[model samples]
Target: MKLAYIVALAAGLAAVAPASAETLLRIGYPGTGLDDRPFGYGDYIAIGHVKQLVEAEFKDQPDVKVTWTFFRGAGPALNESLAAGQLDFAAGLGDLPAIVGRSRGLATEFLASAGSHDPLYLAVPPNSSIHSVEDLRDHKVAQFRGTNLQIATDRVLEAHGLSEKNIRFVSLDSNAATAALVSGNVDASFGGSEYLDLAKHGVVKIIYSTKNDNPTLGRNSGLYVTADFEKAHPDYTAKVVEAFVKAAHFGADEANRQDVFEIWAKSGLPAESFATDFKDERLAHRLSPVVDDYIVARYKDQAERAKAYGLIKKDVDIDSWFNTKYLKQALTDQKLEHYWPTFDAKGQKLTDGEVEQTRAATN
Candidate 1:
């Protein structure tokens, strides 16, 4: 009779336990600031981190602890952590590294588009003679290899009737590349908005940039979760997406434009740089978290480019890798399905009527 009572009590405890109860959640970002600064840049994920959205989301669950890891080696280093099962989720994962990881048998799912249309620039020494992409040929050029920036740089070079073979390519991360450009160690450096600060300080000249240029030339990154983690704790995954989507809403609001910039500035870039980078652009469009047609098409294109550029050996199937059910549910739960506009494959905004149709279809 005593044994029976103990068994009944044990079963009752098990029944009351939360199905998705986790002791800890580990989140990672590919790029860290100088000296491995805890914060990072380039996406809503960074803004969310600064705002402690994920922490607040799990505040009620005292047992659930959230920790973030910022990788100084950038995307490639972040990929290493994910492969070793050291990380559960990756925020602001670049397209190229994610594609390469997927092709190389990293079991992960693309959760949501973290950032898109982030402009690229080519910075030369303050008094350098190089003024065009064509001039970059036969000159030393530096970029972070195995990153989304690499692919964008390749496309830009190809557009100018050149390729990596046509120039001296030096593989360096953003900080190193910026230092090289400023010290004239590299003839030019190609990177994202962070370079604008250098130009503002009269240290570098921005001869070419994707700003107001081809929208397709812009780089893309996204939130990604390892398959093992998602399979084990689906509820935790949903809660994370919901929190990040909330961050997206905060970032997309025009009223919070300056506030959003301030949050991003924590990554070591000045707030004025973000303001200048996003000038004359719609916050909602730039900060939208939805994985709509344009994002899918861009990833698909990125995969193709990766394969063609010899960056990956195997082909990555976009449909199989992209899991957006959580994002849709998050949108519906947050009543934000109609808040952010969806774009077509060519980066054109869909009409309001078409937006409704897209939401219904996803539903």
Candidate 2:
């Protein structure tokens, strides 16, 4: 009887083997530059790729393969692919596109915040008279629409009592915008750290930047997974989250700071650019995976701004969009729940002593 029972179990295991023989996790990102490399500035997903962390997590399962797809057209193109069921996971999706995707009925769960508080710069021709955001009025301004930067551009314009219609807006990717700026085709271009290099080379001058402006205008990035994918493969989703969190820990380590910057410099930008970008900032706070109050409030604000700018048809319920379970579980499983400090809705970090006091008071 025992032999018969063992035989039955063996047959059942064999029957299930083929069903789990193959699993595919398709992760999509916005920039095409990072496609050929394993890392990019401030990109934890790329770090995971460089470390082969995700692949190693599933190494024992020979059937699972992880594929990364990069879309040069940025968020809109990535959303199109997501709509077509071509991507199961996404990282580096900006707040605008993420909200827009949800408004358009793309069911995806926000996994964790990726890059946030990225300063933006408006680069004008080396000899141009443009001196500020207000100076760009009635001028040709290059902006990459349908991405987080678009939202930032709009906010910056509004701050200066201007709107997109007030200026001649030209939609161009980062590279094209840079070329146009240098060639005098566009009056100014809104960009990130790359613009710093242009400024250094005397090709462009930075008229305005978010260095001391409102933090909300800084573009935020997030990681997400399709609702169907999450429901169908919760285990795989959890593993992916673990891998990302592991990468984040590595990125936040002070000892690995220079190495992280070196890996990210493969995108053709100098390592010094990243160093300047992250100057005076803590990597742990910047690369935190915790879904703190600040992240929630920021997304809510971005959704509202998107509606005000006519980027979305209706309001997106930001609260319901987040699936913090994956990140929370990953932190707990990795024993890193308290490794990073938590920030308030205003982006102020609570001191460790303060956190303990708060917990004590609540208890």
Candidate 3:
């Protein structure tokens, strides 16, 4: 009878062990990983990393483990991991590649808009005679083909009545393009805030930027989770969103602006670079997670543009691509429902009721 009791206790212990096993939450970000610091470009996820927000969210559940992987290959490489079921969540995915991934049948749901209306600039050799976008006709222009920078470059060219056909397009990553620009290997290159440093040092000259131009020409980024993960762990997904929203709240506050700039400077760029890039731009507007009419219209337009540019083979249904349930619940749970303003499709502010109507339609 004692032996029978011992066997039964062993079985009960085995069952309880499985329940206490660790649950791994794998997250991916498309940026160069810095030792002892997460990639910080005024993004909420980066802030979350600094503050241990996600880990804090799961602190009560000791069996949960949150792991993050940074990819230097950017969105395309991150998508490959997502496709292989290696990543449960991904952030900093630009408009074009995210659309391409969805069009190719990757089962991921958009969680929230990361950053939008980020200006892109065209940089040429400091000594070069290229003074404007129109001067690049028949010249070699280095562009990163598979990223949102490609779309920004295309739109800038179109705005100047020029196309890729007008230039000899060279495919290169941002670092490579920057090197090429400094060495005069490419007549000009298009990129983001890094170019500000190059210009400051006389290595490159900024000919044009999308700051006050067509907002569509600028870049937008977002965060996403695998559909399977979201479906299987809705409560966990909610917690993740809550953590990110909490970070967003901190990132958007005016009091944290200086600290954000200082933290992001750890990515090897000077604090002045972030300040110059974000000049005259509201931090809250850039870091907002709200899926308003502007977010929907911008992504829908990106899909149509990508299709027109022959970048993607099929149309992407932007409406079904998003899972706003998590974000809505996060806002309510965090009491940040009215923290950020809503914008229309044209980037204009909307009344509170209009914002509610938009949220209602999505819900």
Indicate which candidate wins on TM-score: 1
- Candidate 3: tens digits of C-alpha lDDT, residues 33-78: 3342356565777777778888999999988999988777778888
Report the Cα lDDT for residue 17, model 1: 89
Query: What's the TM-score of every candidate structure?
Result: 0.90, 0.88, 0.89
lDDT of 1 by residue, 93-211 (tens): 88898999999999999999998888888999989999999999899999899888899899899888999899999999888998888888899999887888879999888999887
* Predicted candidate 2 versus true structure: per-residue lDDT over 1-363, tens digit per residue: 999999999999898778666778898888755333433466677678778898888998888999888777879989999999999998878888989999999999999988777788888988898888888889998999999999888888998899998999899987788889999999999988877766777878888878678755677889999999999999999999999999888887766889888877777777787787777766665676777887898899889989988889898988899998999999889888887777677766655422234444766
Residue 307, model 1: lDDT of: 91
Go through the candidates in order and give the C-alpha RMSD of each one to the true structure: 5.5, 6.0, 5.1
| Candidate 1 Cα lDDT to native | 0.87
- Write the number of the candidate with greater TM-score, choosing between 1 and 2: 1
What is the Å distance of residue 327 in model 2 from its true position? 0.5
Model 2, residue 85: distance off in Å is 0.3
Clashes of each: 0, 0, 0
**Could you give me the TM-score of model 1 versus the true structure?**
0.90
- Highest lDDT among the candidates is held by which one? 1
Candidate 1, run of 10 with poorest lDDT: 351-360
Query: All models: lDDT?
Result: 0.87, 0.83, 0.83
